[model samples]
Target: MSGDHILETQDLTREFKGFVAVNKVNLRVRRGTIHALIGPNGAGKTTCFNLLTKFLQPTSGRIFFEGQDITREAPAQVARRGVIRSFQISAVFPHLTVLENVRVALQRKYLGPSFQFWRSERTLNVLNERAMELLHAVDLQRYADLPAVELSYGRKRSLEIATTLAMEPRLMLLDEPTQGLGIEDVDRIRQLIKKVAADRTVLMVEHNMSVVSSIADTITVLQRGAVLAEGPYAQVSANPAVVEAYMGSANVELQGAH
Candidate 1:
């Protein structure tokens, strides 16, 4: 519950029926810092995110956000508390114009109980302006008027980030933001994430080591549903267990040497 930490988990565990997916996890995310969670497939990275965002409730653990316990909060409730998540797949509304899609997301942030379409034109325009600012922040302003369905794959991902920014989250949970991106696109997204995390906390599940090393202030290596090592990039990558887990013994010392 320290002010410097935006998120803290106390023995966070998630189970499916009788099987434990995310074992007792104690994660700490510093305020305004970018933290990367990396591991091989089935390492419980995504499940941890689900527990934080309330997409899945932990079987027996507590999640604290900004010093408040929110373990049993619902997904929408967690989001309203300023903890938002962006999925791996693009979640933009394909039929809507790019600008319109962003505007809709912004509206959702402020609408609360009202129906936006039924509101005044001025109100909608105000929301549109805010959305445009978010779009430009993510470098999708040029495609504002284009139908989202027609945007390139990378552009669509940018739009998704823009939409999430419209929510004005204090902490963002990014699940493989660069999963299918090419090298160039991946670099762009990495830079965007760095920019976004400058004044906010970001906890991302990224498999790309280069991307993680470039942007992450700290990296947590997870294995078999538990944290194997957590520290700065150099420290965690140098851990014998982490090196062995990723590339066997061959690539271990070599990567650490760098």
Candidate 2:
């Protein structure tokens, strides 16, 4: 294991009813790098993310984070170790204001498992300052008082990112961060991701090649649950196998780097 890597998987494999969802795959994410996992429809990207986040236990293999073996750790335990995952669906509370949602996340981190519901208003008020800072980070300060459900699709995703940031994770695992958004929203989220990755490590599963090329420091191309190629955008984009994997996709061009 290299000292520079924040996360690594050794022959990570997962199976469902005799069907292999994630094959024997070894993955490494360097510290403070934005790494992307891209592939065709059934490439096991989600499964791989699940395995890393401990949402789904692997059938075999091991996971390591910050030089510690986390393969057998629970999801919450992994999260406490600074590995957090954001889902494809926005995880924000529908009725809670954006500021309140981020405050709740901060509460979880600071208050711990024995959090009391009857805590005084002053206690919650102390978290407001930090929560607003998080909202500002994701450009959600303007909508801080609005209910999460009232935001546009892209704004909801931004709020989700803000809440995740409140956890102060060392490695963030994002599953399809830009899925289902307009071009303008996609661009906004892309910029937000780049900004966040400046201070932490991010491993995301993204299909949009343009966004991947624009923000990813390293790209891992998967095919049928196994890695086909891994390198910088310039190298992986020109790989013959990667090009053939996305042969018919009009939007994904494996010849250019953004």
Candidate 3:
């Protein structure tokens, strides 16, 4: 692995009993770059993500973060090291107010307060200010006072991204960020992601070709748990193997349209 790589996998593999969910896979994400992973459903993309984030341990090979071996690191430890994941599904607390959810996330960095205690008015006020800053960054300040469950689907996802930013991550893992978003919401989220990624590295699993092409600095096409191709948007899109694996015969027609 190169010294400058922020994240890398060497022959990473995961198995459940006799079945291999993720086969030998190697990946290298450059520092401060947006690297996208694209693949079809059941192509082992999620499995590879789980293994990298330490949600599941790899059956073989190693994972390195910041040039250090972190293959067996606990998920919390990995996250604390500035690598955080924003789940595909909303992970916010629906019962909590939007501001409260963000404050909870911010307060987690300081272990002095018990999770059960309602923060003092002064402390809450400070946390609320910071939460609003993050909310505003994600274009979610207007919904900050509402109950999280009452927010629209797109807003809920925005809240998730805001909460993740409360941790001030150096590297972010995003899973299907634009899924289920309307065109407007998709555009907003895409811009929000780019804003957050200005100084941090973002590794995302995205299926939308338009989204990938718009945001990805480099693309890795995965198939059957391994990388099929890796390059810039135009290069990967033109690769015959990648086209067959994901875009299918229609890719030729799509390319013609472009």
Using lDDT as the measure, the top candidate is 2
lDDT of 1 at 171: 93
Q: What global local distance difference test value does model 1 have? A: 0.85
Please name the candidate that would achieve the greatest TM-score relative to the true structure.
Answer: 2
| lDDT of candidate 1 over 130-212, digit per residue (tens) | 87788889898888889999998888888988888888899988999998889899888998999898878899998778888
TM-score of every candidate: 0.92, 0.95, 0.93
Q: How displaced is residue 47 in candidate 1, in Å? A: 0.7
Q: Write the per-residue lDDT of candidate 3 for residues 168-257, one digit (tens) a residue.
A: 888899999888888888888888888888989999997667777888899887877878889888998889887777555322231532
* All-Cα superposition RMSD per candidate: 2.6, 1.5, 2.4
lDDT, residue 153, candidate 1: 88
The local distance difference test score of each candidate is 0.85, 0.91, 0.84
Model 3 regions more than 4 Å off: 111-114, 247-258
Indicate whether candidate 1 or candidate 2 has the larger TM-score: 2
Which ten-residue region of model 1 has the weakest summed lDDT? 249-258
